[model samples]
Target chain A: MISIKNLSFAYKKKPVFDGLNLQFKAGHVYGLLGKNGTGKSSLLRNIAGLLYPQNGSITVNGFTPFERLPVFLEDVFMVPEEFYLPDISVPDFIKHYAPFYPRFNSEKFRNYIAVFEIPADSTLQNMSYGQKKKVLISFALATNARILLMDEPTNGLDIMSKSQFRKILAEALDEEQCIIISTHQVKDLENLIDRITIIDEGKILFDENVETITKKLSFRFAYDAEDVAAAIYSESSLIGNVIVAPNIDGDEGKLDLELLYKAIITNSEKITKLFQQ
Target chain B: MNQFFSLKRFTLLVLKHWADNKKRYGLSVLAFIGLLITWFVFTMLTGFDNIPMGKAVQQITFFLSLFAVGTFYASQYFRDLGSRSKGINFLLVPASAFEKLLCSLLYSVVLFFIVFTTAFYLIDVLMVAIANSLPGTEKLAGKPNVINVFKVIILRFNSDSTINFLLFFFSVQSAFLLGSVYFEKYSFIKTIICGFVAGFILFCMMYFFYEHLLPNGGFHKGFLTSFRVHVDGVNDHLVQVPRWIGEVFRFLIMYGIAPFLWIVTYFRLKEKQV
Candidate 1:
């Protein structure tokens, strides 16, 4: 579990995040939704204790992350968008890094690597970017950390690898562990993330469960724009129009992430009010 | 158990770094050996006597060893800052700031001293042995006494002598550490510039206050008079401060600069972007 209170950060005199407060609970996968330059990465880094906020404090599992106590560090892991693995082979990295993570499951790591098709003998530096990310992600999961922070994890992966990534992530989830993933590609995390947290202008706009959202709003196709009545938000495609309408009929429909994202950003107040109702 | 785990983590980190850069470490060792050979050849070609060779070798080795240590420390520190992979991996490890600081300090100070001193002694002994074996090298007959050399080295760090050395060492390290943490880009150069700028600014402030703002301030006169008397006495060949006091004052000054530098570095680190 993680809690951030009134967090504000600045670069030089320019503010990046201000008065941001949010809490995350364990046992669910969280999709951190945001636009470019929305301080998504910065927020992840702050939670990871890699970057210190100019104001506010972040606590992970009741320990201040910035303090970076062993207890806090042992239970948390962050996988960034870009990473480098030393020239050492996978085995060498394991030999050197496994001791630091008390719960490190070497067997699981080996299994995951095999599943991911990462060559054990290949030097990490020699691998492709996606491969390197896979190794890091696999290793991160193997650590059995209580909390995991991932930033743009599927940025450079091929479509197959992205699905493979989702499968691996889904399989890795447990009741005791929480994973917070920040990415612009909501489609990548569709059906995988249980909760969604949207950030814009350095502030969290909404934090709602997928089930709650689907129950309150219905995503349906309308043949004509006129058929969509008092919808929260709608977008037109070649076939028809997709609209988010109030669940007044108490209809439970599949949540449309793309439309929900648009509604949250374009008409956030209306969406927030609808959710409140 | 936790302490043991922490130690294991530290060792793991060091081993990982070594494994990753084994080639670089090997090259550094090879370069040092080459330097040793060059020193021996130069002495032989110049026909320098044993005493001169000993003295020159001692001074050169001392400096060379220091340079080696400084280069390794600076390069590793800066390289980590510049490296995205290494930096992220390092930060990911669940260690306290104190533990991280201790590890860095150990690498810069304790490990460096051990490596440099061992290399210095080994190279010195080998060079001396070769010199003694050469024709017309009778002047190099007397071998360096190991026990005496060690005693000299140990005595140099006595309470009286160690103060100044420690002060200077800490000041330099603090400057480097601050630089490593402050600038996300071009940290090495920025550190140097920041140090110079800080020193210059302090100098100017002192000069202004003493020379223009308060031309006849009694505080300045008293301080300068005491400083002058101290310097004059040390060189007068008559009255001098006791050796112990001199050593202690030297150490105090060196260490005094460390906390201030560390405080600044800490603030800079807190504001780090990455």
Candidate 2:
């Protein structure tokens, strides 16, 4: 569980986040959607206690993360976008780092490593970037931390590894743990993330469950460029025109993320009105 | 006991780092040996028989040993910076700033003092024995004994002058530590510039107050007079100032400035975009 209130941050007199507020709870995979240079990583760092917010407060599991007590540290882990492991074997790293985490499950770590096919004898520094990310992810999960913050985790992985990554992440989920993943590749987390939080212009634009999104909006395909007045947002595709229709009829249709994003940006007033109704 | 255990962990980390870069350590050791050999050969060739080798060794050991300390300290700081990929691991550890600072200071300064002193004394004894046995350098050697070296080390520790020297060394080291945390790039140079700029600003403020402000009767002369008297009264035979005040000042400056810099650094280091 996490709470951020009136969190504002600036760099060199330029505002990155202003009065941003949000909350997160356990039992859901959150997709932190945001554009480049939109303070996605900055927000994640603030939550991880890596960087302190210039103004406002952040509480994680009833403790200020910046305090970084042993109990808090043991229950929180962050997988940074750019990471390096010391020139030590996987086993050696575990041996040295595991004792710090009281709930560290060495057996689970070994199992995940085996399942992921990571070499036991390989030094982490010698591994590829994607491989190292996997190793860190596996180790983080094995720590049994209640809160995990990951940034751009699927950036360097190959297609197979990406799918494998998704599978492992899904399998690693539990009712007590909360994972906040910030990434641009929304498609990679299509079915994995249960909730979506979109941040733009230094503020959260939308925060809703995927199921709620599906029930509240309908994506329809049109054959021609007819101005369907009922359509909240419409875009032309090669095969047809894809349109987002308000869910006044109670038609439960699959929510097209790209379409929904376009609708929220281009016709925000209409979308907001529909949600209000 | 907590401090001791934390120190042990710090030592382990440093050893792990050294093990990871054994080649660099080996190169440094070879360079040290080469320097020692050059000094030894130069003394033999010059026929400097009047110079007491023991005293010369002690002097060289004291000064050159600082080089070992300086190099190790600088390298450790740079190495930690270079390990940015793993920076979060070190930064996020559940250790207080004081614990981390003490561990770093002790491992680099105190440990280096112990190890280098012991090893260099042994090397000095061996060199003296070899010089005494050589045909051309018979007068170059004195009584080669460990007791004399131990006496020199013990006497150095007991001397009041040594305490003042250590205080100054520690003060400078504290400044460097603060510098290490202040600037992300070229921290050493930035720290030096910052020190000079701060000192100059303080000097200018004092000069203005004494020259202009005091002339207008804006301040009390008794304050300045008392300050001068206080400073003069603290002057002593061995220490330039009373040891207690010097120690208190050192502790206050180091503890105060180091943590402030560390907190500034914590806020300054942002998460890099990938």
> Per-residue lDDT of B1-274 in model 2, one digit per residue for the tens?
2522355555545554444455555676567666765676676568544442446555555555655455435434533543545667665554544445555555555765565566566666667676666664445445433334333343353454444444445555555655565445676667667779989999999988777654323222232331232234355122144556666765665455545544443333322211
Estimate how well candidate 1 is docked, as a DockQ score. Answer: 0.47
* CA deviation > 4 Å runs, candidate 2: A227-230, A247-251, B1-54, B64-68, B71-75, B78-84, B140-159, B193-274
- Cα TM-score per model: 0.81, 0.79
lDDT for each candidate structure:
0.74, 0.69
Top candidate, metric TM-score: 1
TM-score of chain B of each: 0.65, 0.56
How large is the C-alpha RMSD of every model relative to the true structure?
5.4, 6.5
In angstroms, the error of model 2 at A200 is: 1.2
DockQ of 2: 0.25
| Model 1: per-residue Cα lDDT over B39-74, one tens digit each | 667866785545424654565555545644554364
- Per-residue lDDT tens digits for candidate 1, residues A1-277, read 7889999998787788998999899899999988888888888888877778889888889887776667778888889887767778889889887777889999889888888888877788788888998999999999999999999999888898898889888888999999999988888888899999999988889999998988898889888656575777888888888898778777677877878899889999998888887
User: For model 2, what is the C-alpha lDDT against the true structure?
Assistant: 0.69
Per-prediction fnat values? 0.69, 0.24
lDDT of 2 at A129: 85
Worst 10 residues of 2 chain A by lDDT: A222-231
> What docking tier does model 1 reach?
acceptable
Model 1, stretches more than 4 Å misplaced?
Answer: A228-231, B1-23, B35-54, B68-72, B82-85, B127-174, B183-251, B254-273
